[model samples]
Structures are given as structure tokens and as C-alpha cells.
Target: MELTVDERWDLIDKISKQTITFGRYSHTLKDAIAEITVKPLTGIPIAIAVMYGFWSFFGAFAGFFTDGFFVKIFDEHWLPWLQKVFPGEGGFLYYILVGDPTADNCFEAFGMLTSGLFVAIGVVLPAIIAFYLFLIIMEDSGYLPRLAVLIDTILHKIGLHGFAIVPIVLSLGCNVPAVTATRTLETKKQRFMMATLLAIFIPCGAQLGMMIEIIPGYVGFVMLYLLIGFFVTGFVLNKIIPGRSPEILMDVPPYRMPTVRNIGRKMWMRVKGFLFVAIPFVMLGVLLVNVLYWWGVIDWLADILEPVLSAWFGVPKETVGPLLAAFLRKDLAIAQLSAIEMTTYQLITSVVLINLYFPCVATFAMILKEGKEGGCKSAPIFLLGSLATLVATVFLFGGLLHLIWIILGVA
Candidate 1:
């Protein structure tokens, strides 16, 4: 009753500690999971293992949907029906819409309903579903934050804080929102660096899905190459860009069993986006590419960029079309790459380059907006410089990887 202020404050703190202890002890499962996931020694390895599982499942699931189901329907029903209705297979409109009916596969038959729909619905959509499902699970289960914690030291060495991992992970889903999310970063430098890294190296789920479909056994290698590029570019930018990386100060929420309703709602939002927004853009990309081809624009561009494409990148001149298409949509660009007949090395090289070159149109706009809002007056200059650096880095990295593969007798 006669206690001083300091004594009363001490008593209050003790009671608060007791309350917190009881609350924490009540969530035994959450604490147990955290003990493993947040420990320095085991955390990184576990995160890698989880990521590997995600990719493996994504590949298998997407493959089942694309090759087993969608391809069959497209080949057996959609293509034949379209050919019957629009009989002039060799006509200009038919060629533009349906591609070459005589082509062996839907991928080679570069038509809107044929190759485009097949890619968007069959290949990319399935991959998107798998990715979002996995991502949703991670988000619900609270593993993603632990992943950030696990990688925070490495990220800091490369000039990013742990919080940057949010955008990095989001970029895997889609770069536009990822770029928008850069607002969560504290400094202009961090945002710019993060955005640059994302645009350059993080292949969106759609693109990754297409890579999985097209390259089959080689998607992992491609991803590895891009990840290396990401770190290398980030390190270089950290040195070149003049700014201090802020420390990551974030709250790690409690782990809980994800409610089915919440998971379903989140999954539906992402799936709806893929079905409506992404698919239409993919079709538009296909149509635009075909129009450019018929108008001889693609040929002109290919000829103009032939030396760089063929000599520098080790890809054919036809790759210029897909490279250009990457600006519109990266997934569509990868789909277009499927039509080209090239060596595996060249295919890998092209995929690396596309991923490192630039973001899609939407992401590009978001980067600009974010830059301006963050008071970066020289946003365009920074972006151009970043693009130039990325181009050089990817070419060098791809060549080195190919050389190593050749030496190992894998190429």
C-alpha cells in the first residue's frame, strides 16, 4: 500500500511477464515449429528443402494438367474444330489466328487458339495454380517470415534487409505487385535496388511454369542461374549505389492452422487473376507477335538484332521476337521460345536473358511510379543502367554455366 513508483512499475512488469509466459506456453505447437524453423543452423536448410519440394510438386502438377489433359483436348478437339470451321489453313487470317495447321505440335503451330490458348490455359495456368497453392500454404502456416529470418544475414550482405524478402517472394508470383510492395522498404536506394533485382532475376510464376513445361528437366538449372544472377547483381548494386541498408524490423506472427475458408478465398483471388487478367494478356501477346510477324516487323527486328542474338547470346535470330515479346509479358515470351529449334544451351541462355533483361509492362510502370514517389529524380537513368548491367551479367553468367555444363559433359 505504501510502495514507491519504481516498485509498483517492477511489480507490473513481473505480472506482464507471467501473463506472456502463460500465453506462449498455451501454443506449444507454434513454439515447437519455431524452434526448428528459426534456429540459425537448421533454418536455412529447411527453407531450401521446402522450396525444392514446392518446385517439384509444381512441375509434376503442371505437367499433369498441361501434357495429360489440356494438350489432348486442344489437339483432339479444339484444333480440329477450328480447322474445320475456318477452312483456309493457308490463308492470311487462318495463318494469323491458327498458325500452321501442318505443324507437329500445338507449340509449333503458333496460333491464337492453338499455341496461345494451350500455353495460357494448359501450361501457365496449371503452374500458377500450383504456385499459388503452395504460396498460400506458406503464408497461412507462417513459414515465409521464418524464411526471411533465415536469409536475413545473407540479404544484408547483399544490401537488402530481411523485409526485402517479401517483394522477392511476391515477385515470384508477379513482379507488378512486387514492385508496388517496394513501398514497404524504408529508403529510396533499397526500393530501387530491390526493384532492379526483382525485374532482372526473379522469374514470375507464369514464366517459371512455362520454363518447366518447355525445358522439362532443365528448369532447376535455369532457376539456379537466375538466382546466381540475382545475388551477383545485388552485390554489385550494393557497391555502386550509395545508400545504407536499413535493418529489418518486422513482427513474426503466430502460426495457426489455416482456415479452409481463408485459403479458398486467397486461392480464388489468385486463380481468378490468372484466368482473366493473365490469360487475356497472353492472348494479346500472341496476337501482337503474329501481327508483327505477318507485317515483317519481326523479321526486320530479327535482322537488326541478329548479330547480338546469334553471336552474343548464342541463340538464333528468331529469338529476337520472343525477347521483344518479353516486354509485353514474360510468360508469353517463354512460350514463344518453345517454337524455336535450338540447342539446350541456347534455350537455357535465352531463358536467363529474358528473365534478366526487363520486367513486363505492368511491372515496369510500377517501378517507375515507386521510383518517383520515393523521390528518385533519376529513376529512368537508374533503370537503364540496371538493365544494361543485367544484360551483361546474364550473358556472362549464362556463358559460364554453359561452359561448365559442357566440361561436365552435361550440355
Candidate 2:
């Protein structure tokens, strides 16, 4: 009456399955509760507080240079020499080298260029460094996995899962790295979904830093609007796209404080990478826009784009200059907005539009890389979807604000 070998194995398999259920069922529920609570409540708040503290300190440090030190540089050397060297010859070179100094458009002066650099180096750089440092610390310390687990439910609604946090969070520092971080996602669908969201809605450090400059006295309110936009657009994307949220099996690396050496090296590498890659694009964007303007191509292009930009978005024709730069670098677009005068609504809209605008060259490359790596045959969907979202958001928000203005009468 002894069982055969096959019968014995079947008995073992059944017992194993039951044993697994008995052993792991409680652990699963406990882990779920722990991950979710940490992500939305405590984890997110800690991240925000860390962000505020880092920025507050970084701003004070950057302000010293931007307000005091860079001012001296402009006053002492850059402005006087540029004026002497360029000297009253009203040509394109004069205009490019020394932007209208008198705060008027027609005159050739060094103020705009100086102001732009100070904004770029003194303000943007410090914030960028500090922000990137915080991100690296979070990433290496392994809190990111819990963050992913915590937000999995919300992210799932958008065809992604908790792991998408890596890219979305990094997008705050820079879309380029955020896009690259998509490599951590297992499936092509997840990467594409996350990448599309990152490009359309996430403002990089430069963009946010620029908004800090121009948003003017209501930064808090503008930020709240942006947060609302992110969640709304993300929620809509979840409903519209047909896909299951990928399994969230992130590796929770051990929670240890990031070492000083490791943190310094990480920050240095990120800063160096930013400068090497981003600065050239910024300078080139500046050069290209100036050349295009000088040659009248920019004007022609702006004329063609004017109706859509002005009527729909309520942005001026001059915005086309910054939009052109946006394709090269998202930060540059935001930084460029500072040169122009915009109402608070216009400022917020411009920030949102620029954020939701075209992906940078780096992000485009990352998208292509991810497509290749993830075996996604339908990669173009991300690009198209992102563009659609950006256009829709701009128009929708623009219309809403226009109605609000009509109702409110600009106070």
C-alpha cells in the first residue's frame, strides 16, 4: 500500500504550497501597510522637509555670490569692458555680446547676459548641487524602495507602480537623470509610462529655480497649483492608458547613513556632469537664439507660432525664444523666462508649460536607450503621449485662468 514516487512528490508539493501560505501570508500584509504609510505620509514629508532645509541653506549660500559677489563681477569687469570693447556699434555681435543694457530692448548692454549668468551660476548651481546631493543620499541610503512601496497604489493608477518614484523624484533634480533612472524599472511599458510622465510634468532644478526668481511673492500658491497639476494629469494618465501596473519588486538596500566620502563624490560627479553636459547646451542655446534673432528667422518663426502661443497660452510671441531653447535644455527655458516681464499667472503658466514642454535632448536620448533596452516596439507612444498631455494641460489651464481673470479682473 506504499505510495509510488510520483504520488510522494505530489504530496510534498501540496504540503510545500500550504506551508508557504502559512508562513508568508501575515508578513505580506504587514509589509504592505508599512510600505504604504511610509511613502505617502512620513517619507514624503521628510523628503519635503529635507528639500526645504537644503534649499534654504543653499539659497543663502548662492545668494551671497548672486547678490554680492556676482554683482561685483558685473560692476567691476564684465560690464565696463564689454561696453568699451563693443562701443556703440549697433550690430548683431554687439547685441549678442552685450544684451540691451538699459533695460530696454533696443540698446546694447551687458545687463541681461550678466543677470542670466548670475542666475545660472550663483542661484541655479547651488540649488542644483544641494538638490542632487539630497537625491543621491536618498537613493543610496535605500529609502527609495520604501518610497516606491509607499506610493505604489497611486503610481499604479497611472500604469506604473512605486518604483516609478526614482525617476519622478530625480526629475526634480534634472529630467536627464530621471529619464536615465528608468533603467531601474523592469518592463518597457513601465519605463515608457514613467518617462512620459516625467517629461511632461516634472520640472527640473533649473526650471524650479527660475520660477523661484520670477514667481514673485506667491511662490507657495504657484507651487500648490503645480502639485495639483501633477496629480491631476497623472491620475488622468492612469485612467486613459490601458495596462496593468508592473509588479513592484524593488530591492531595499540596507538603511545606512550615506558616508561623507560617498556623498561628496556623488555630489561632485553630479555637479561635474551637469556642468559638462548642461552648460554647453545653455551657451549654445543662447548663441543659437541670438543668431536666429539676428538673422530674422526667430521673428518669422515666432510670427508663425504667435497665434497659438498668444491666444491659447496667453504667452507673448517672445516666448518662442525660450521655447526654442527648451528643446536643448529644460532649465534654460525656465531661466530664459526670467529675462521677460510676466504677470504672476503668466509666470505660473510659463513654468508649467515649460515643464510640460518638449523633452530635453538628454531625455530624448534616454528614451531611445530605454526603448532599446526594454524591448519596447511601441516607443514612440511615449513621445506622442507626452506631447499630447503637455498641449492639453497648457490649453486647459490657460482657458481656466483666462476665465478666472475674466471673473476676477486682474485685481
Candidate 3:
């Protein structure tokens, strides 16, 4: 009953035509949204709006919780009680733990427990929670893919594809995870560039939170400067680093309502991880700075570095301690910097310097870990190369700001 191959195929085609029904399918709203969000013209504007909303929410939520609630608790109730109750009014332990006995607020206290706990729990934690919440919502709701597609071309200019945006955004929250996220990159070159640039350029959420709290007026300008440095440096690195900045085709999934349970779970897990890293480093920063200051090392270094700092960067030499603390945690360094007496412009410059000075301890270890996997470059070479690039960038960019300030009569 079986016919030859060609005859059987011809019979099947004839039968299929008669049996199968063809009909027009309607495009749903989800499909329409998917189309517009992936297209460049519509997607770019929407992406901008999304980011604007993200920032707005982050500021409002973090500010409300940090300023309206925690600031009061830390500054008024906790600090005064600690200052009064702790023994050894003029002794070392008192100074290290309770800070200035006469100081009225946590910001000026500059002690291991007072400022460290306040920055880690009160200020940075709120910002971390808010940032991760917004990010998770975007992820579960399916907007992240579109964002990746939207920015793919621009990112390619920096030797990264669209997916590279994951690490870039994550770096804003914490560089440790962000460095890990670089594994998703297709090549070692992209990983090295992304990790190194992020470590040097992008200030983490903790640092950003402190910036907002301490210098609300100047935060925007500082951020703009850093962002410009990020792209300009990225573009330059893309040119020199050997790699193929390949294009990516990402799927734009249909939008759906993100579940509250998933959002809460992810936010909690991230914040928990952050607390472990943030609290210890913040405490360590206070301990090291206090010990070094107690030992007069900071003073010696300040005296030695003064002429160069004053002449080149236009910041006070007192920033030497804060600069050292910046290696442990940038948020801690920024808090320390706020206690020092400085002009507004100097504060802005110092903040920028703290950002560009060095990556935190955790981030440094993470970079070292992820960097070794680079097939193109050895880990030691990567570390050395990154340090050299960082030194060059700090001098060039920091001095450029100093020069601009001089021109504007603000230096």
C-alpha cells in the first residue's frame, strides 16, 4: 500500500491542504507592548522614563526612611545615650566607640559604633532595600530585557553587549555581586573591562546614599561627573582592549504583573547579604582610621601628601584618613569626610575622589576572583593593569575637575 517517496509526499500534501484550517490570529496587548518597547524610537523614551521613575522612587523611599525616621533615632536618642553612659569620658575606648562626648549627632561622632552602625543600618540599608526592590520589580515584570535591547548598541561602543548592563546596574547596588555578574559576558575582554571600570568609576548604593544624605545639593553634579567619566573611560578602553564587541539579540518577553512574594524574597536576600558586607567593613573602617589617627600615622601621611593634594586636587590633606577608609567601604569614607571642615566645592571634590580612589575590600577580592578566569590576560597582569589605569584616571579626571573649579573660581 506504500507508494514511492515522491508520490507519498504528493498525496500527503494534497490531504493536508484539505484537512488543515488556516485562520487569522489577533495580536494581544502584550504583543503590542513587546513590539514598542523593543523598537528604538519608542523604547528609548520609555527607558528614560523608567529610569527617571526608578531614581525618583529610590530617593523618596530611602530619604523617607533614612531621614524622617533613622536620622532622628540615631542622632538624638542613641548617640546622646551612648556618649553619656559609656565610661572613660576622656579615654581611648570611649573615643573609639562613643566618639566625641560633646558631639550631639551621629554624623559628627566618627566612632566605630555610632557612625558605623548609623551608616550601615540607618542610611545605606534603606537605600539598598529601595534600590533592590525597584530592580527586582523591573526584572520580574520583564522590563529588564527591553532595557538591555534598548541600550545594546551604545554599550557596544564600550566593548560590552546588552547583557553587560546586568553587571553595570548591579554594580550600583554592590560591586561584589556585580563583578560576579561579569561571568555572563561572552569574552574575557568584556569581563575585565566591565569589572575594572565599574570598580573604579561606579559608586555603590551605600556611597550614593551617603552622598545624598550629606551633600544633597551637590549629589547630582557629582553623579553627572562620574557618569561622564564612566562612558569616556569605557570608550577609550574599548578602543585599546583586544576583543570583539559582538551584538546581542535578546528576547523581549511579554509583560506580566510581578508577584509581591518574589519581589520581597529577592529584596530580603540581597539586603541580608549587604548587611553582612556593609556592617563589618564600616566597623573596620572606623577601627582602622581611629587606630591610624591614634597612632599619628594619618597626620604624618597628611603632612607628607599635603603639598601634592593642595596643589593638584585642591582638597584638604585631612582627607588622607577618609581616603584610606574608602578602601574598606566608600560609604564609611564619605561619612568620615563629612565630619571634616571643608568648603562646599571641596566636599564635592572629596566625594568624587573617594569614589575614584579605590574599590572596597569585598569588591577588590571579588574582582581578583573573577579576573583570574580571563583567558586573554593573567590575573596578576589584570590587577596591575587595572591599578595603573586607576592611578592615571584619578590624576587625569580628578585634576580635570580641580582645573574646572579653578576656572569657575570655585577652587
For TM-score, the strongest prediction is 3
TM agreement with the true structure for every prediction? 0.90, 0.80, 0.92
- Clash pairs (backbone) in predicted model 3: none
lDDT of 2 by residue, 1-411 (tens): 899999999999999887865434454654654454465666677656655776676556555655567556754777666666766657666667566645422112323364445555655786687577767777776767776776777777667777778788888888777888887777655666677777766777776665665564655565566667777777777677776555766666556668899988988898888678777766666677677878898789889998887777777787787788788866667766766767766766666677666778788777667666654656566556666776787677656655665577751
State each model's CA lDDT, in order.
Answer: 0.82, 0.68, 0.88
Tens-place lDDT per residue, model 3, 266-359, is 9878877877756887898898888888889999999999998899999999999999999988998999888899899888989999999878
TM-score for candidate 1? 0.90
Clashing pairs in 1: none
Candidate 1 vs candidate 3: the lDDT winner is 3
lDDT computed for candidate 3: 0.88
Tell me how far candidate 1 lies from the true structure as C-alpha RMSD in angstroms.
Answer: 4.1
Q: What lDDT score goes with residue 227 in model 3?
A: 87
Tell me the deviation in Å of residue 62 in model 2.
Answer: 3.8
- Which prediction has the highest lDDT against the true structure? 3
lDDT for each residue of candidate 1 in 267-325, tens digit (9 for 90 to 100): 89998877888778878888898899989999998899888666555678898889888
